[model samples]
Target: MEEFTQQAGPFTDAQQWWIEKIADATAATETDFAPKLLEGFPFSARGGTFGFLHDFGREAAINLLDELRRALA
Candidate 1:
């Protein structure tokens, strides 16, 4: 994920600090039935695949935060 961090460019600034939020979300959401999904989020890919994986996590973070943000807002 660190590798992706470096390449996330414009998004890097937006998401760089979101890592903790993402992680917390992952932990909370995965604490029950979805635990496996968050535990072994494999990142073993290359090139385009890596990019997708990178974006996957970021998008996932955003997706998970959607409801949280809305509720808070």
Candidate 2:
């Protein structure tokens, strides 16, 4: 399972884009979501097929979406 669980962040990257769109549409800028996204990491290290940061970003995106859903609900 771990072998198949390659680190991936493109999904997270795209997710953040949508979130930004929503924020723009609503004129909202929540610091919570405003983490130096690509901070502390190189561009090449972000959307790889395997890495701890990638996995972390994926999980973070999931949680962020969930929060958005609940808030909107």
Candidate 3:
């Protein structure tokens, strides 16, 4: 995941900091679920796929929060 992030660029500063939030969300959501999904796949694929989803979902959710914060501000 870190390797992919390095190649992609852009999320290397403040945005990169938000990754903790994403990781937390992923851990909470997948703790029980990913095992089911990964049952037949290669063991190494787990981290990559989990990270991909975390980065995607966290960015999306934060984008949504922009409006809420604006309205509440």
Q: Which numbered prediction scores highest in TM-score against the true structure? A: 3
In candidate 2, which residue pairs clash? Answer: 7-49, 7-50
Sort every candidate by TM-score, greatest first: 3, 2, 1
Instruction: Tell how far residue 48 is off in model 2, in angstroms.
Output: 15
Report lDDT (Cα) of residue 26, candidate 3. 41
Q: Which ten contiguous residues of candidate 2 have the minimum total lDDT?
A: 1-10
TM-score of each: 0.26, 0.30, 0.32
Candidate 2 on 1-73: residue-level lDDT in tens?
1121233233455445454443443334443333344333332244422332354457765665456444433
For model 2 the local lDDT of residue 55 reads 46
Q: CA lDDT of 56 in candidate 2?
A: 48
Q: Candidate 1: where is the Cα deviation over 4 Å?
A: 10-14, 31-73
Question: CA lDDT of each candidate?
Answer: 0.41, 0.41, 0.41
Q: Model 1, residue 49: displacement in angstroms?
A: 27
